[model samples]
Target: MSDPKTEEDIFAEVDAEIAAEEEAAAAEMDEPIGPSDSAVDGPGAGVDALVAERDELQDRLMRALAEAENIRKRGERDRREAEQYGGSKLARDMLPVFDNLRRALDAIDEPSRDVAGGVIEGVELTLRELLNVFGKHGIRPIAPEVGDVFDPQLHQAMFEAPVPNVPKGCIVQVMVEGFELHDRLLRPAQVGVSSTPAS
Candidate 1:
């Protein structure tokens, strides 16, 4: 019959196996625990990666902030423009009505106007009221007087005239008055500019 193993012997064998496992574990720890790549080479490897990531994130954040600011500024500009030029088209359309009224008043001579006093007074009153309304709404005529300096921005020359005493590039006559709404011009004045004398 085979002899049975002693308890002490079994315990010593178990202890030896435990010691071997500890040695193997120690060897594994001494070798290296993670991937043997450059990430574990030195402190600089991890630090560089972290710094690059931080810089990339910072750049992205700055770009996002700049884009947000640009959008806000664009919205503000559009709103201001809309408010400033809101009545431009309608104001422009009504200018012809004013022109016809002026034409009707001009067509009547003084004798005829005196003959029809009531009709003339009614038309004049209407013109005065219309002008008052135009003043209230910031609409004004750009009727330059004769001998005034010609402005290309405000005047459109209908014909050139060589006046005897008027300076060259000066207004010789205003054929049709212009109109403006606030600082913007609705139409440029039809004018006659003095010409330079021939050499």
Candidate 2:
């Protein structure tokens, strides 16, 4: 007893429903997915994270290597310094004995030298032996005498004296000798420097 619907009306309704469904599906796909979505997970995501981790680890490794190299260099410098200055105090104490030996040899008179030949020979031999010991331990003496140029780096002026024939600022007399170890001055020579004579 009911009348049949026209084909055009049925077709229009079905087409409208299909269009709405298609639009809704497109909006859902365009929306940004949050962490709740399982779409951006799996082996590909794990590979990317691993690549970032590897880069950070490589950077840390390079820094660690640089720090280690710096420590090694510092240790080497400390060791060299220790070796160079280890016996400085002992060497300084032995200098007075050498000075006494030199003074004893200087005090002997030329007239009495023949009578005390054995004593003079013993003293000379002892001085040579002491010098040999100094050479063995890298402790050498510097004996800059009068008429030498006054070197502030190796000599300490005790007084200035006017002396003829010697250039001004030259050494007039050496009061005490200097000493060096490995090119470094352990003690500066005590000296008298020359000045121009008064008119």
* Each prediction's TM-score versus the true structure: 0.68, 0.73
- Residue lDDT tens for model 1, 113-139: 879989988888888898888888788
CA lDDT, every model vs. true structure: 0.79, 0.78
After superposition, which runs of candidate 2 have C-alpha atoms over 4 Å from their true positions?
1-35, 38-46
Clash pairs, model 1 backbone = none
- Per-residue lDDT tens digits for candidate 2, residues 1-199, read 8775554554565556555655665566566767766465632454455446555755675686679789999999999977987777888898888888889899999876989989988988998998898788788888887788989998999999888776789988887888888778889999999988655
Number of the top-ranking candidate, with TM-score as the measure: 2
Question: Candidate 1, overall lDDT?
Answer: 0.79
